[model samples]
Target: MVMLDADPAGYVYRVLDGPLPEPSRGGLIRLVGVFEKVLPAISDEYASKYYTQARDLAALATEIEAMRDE
Candidate 1:
């Protein structure tokens, strides 16, 4: 890893030796996508249940991508 930027205000940004590996479509992101497709099949009584899990996973994937050096 290496420091890519810094400031007197104590802010800094870092990056690894190279770009972060791309997330596979058949990976976490894909899993979330699959879950979304499942939602429509679920009855309303259970729609929220599946939706929450899918939403949380999607948020997690976003957070992880944000942290990686793009």
Candidate 2:
């Protein structure tokens, strides 16, 4: 699992390079939903910055999935 403040992109790349199961991999969408729920609830600027980073990480994960399907 990638920590909220850690290098999420790196974690994604590593997971992609390994023998991850299909069902577990499909959970990325749910992960994005988690971030989506947290984003709007954030009122502090500092926390919001992390929320944006989480959003980017979620996007990166989705993009990887799209590229894999191509």
Candidate 3:
């Protein structure tokens, strides 16, 4: 089962406690790379709001990588 909860601050994506399927894993890898590549430009333009978003993305990427390893 997958559940998504969203609010003004951010979102939470909950899924079964196991490795993600290949497609999802691949998508996350790409997502992380894109965010990393764009974050500097985002910071330069958007500043604080984008910094918070970047921090959140980094945290999510770390969690996804740990799940992939498991």
Candidate 4:
């Protein structure tokens, strides 16, 4: 997984290279786009449930960045 530092400007675009079915590729792209758009709106509870660490916001951001980079 690729990890990136978080910034106020948010995530930058990441190019992905590989063979993937059209639907799967599209779904991944859609998920990243949606997350990028809604991330700032995510509540603490939601982040906590998925991230599981109280002080791991940085790690969570890294995971999201990696997803975008995938």
Question: Which candidate achieves the best lDDT against the true structure?
Answer: 2
Q: What lDDT score is found at residue 49 in candidate 3? A: 63
User: Of the candidates numbered 3 and 4, which has the greater TM-score value?
Assistant: 3
Superposed by TM-score, candidate 3 places the C-alpha of residue 23 at a distance from the truth, in angstroms, of 0.8
Cα error of candidate 1 at position 40, Å:
1.5
lDDT string, candidate 3, 1-70, tens digits: 0111121112124323455566756655555565556556654554646554655754575476576677
lDDT of 2 by residue, 1-70 (tens): 2455454554476557863357745666666777777778879998899768767876777777667767
Poorest stretch of ten by lDDT in candidate 2: 1-10
Whose lDDT is higher: candidate 2's or candidate 3's?
2
Better structure of 1 and 3 per lDDT: 3
The sequence of per-residue lDDT tens digits that candidate 1 reaches over residues 38-70 is: 566767776567465545655465455566735
Regions of model 3 farther than 4 Å from truth: 1-19, 43-48, 51-65
Worst 10 residues of 4 by lDDT: 1-10
Compute the lDDT of residue 46 as modeled in candidate 3: 48
lDDT of 4 at 12: 22
User: Rank order by lDDT, top first?
Assistant: 2, 3, 1, 4
Regions of model 1 farther than 4 Å from truth: 1-26
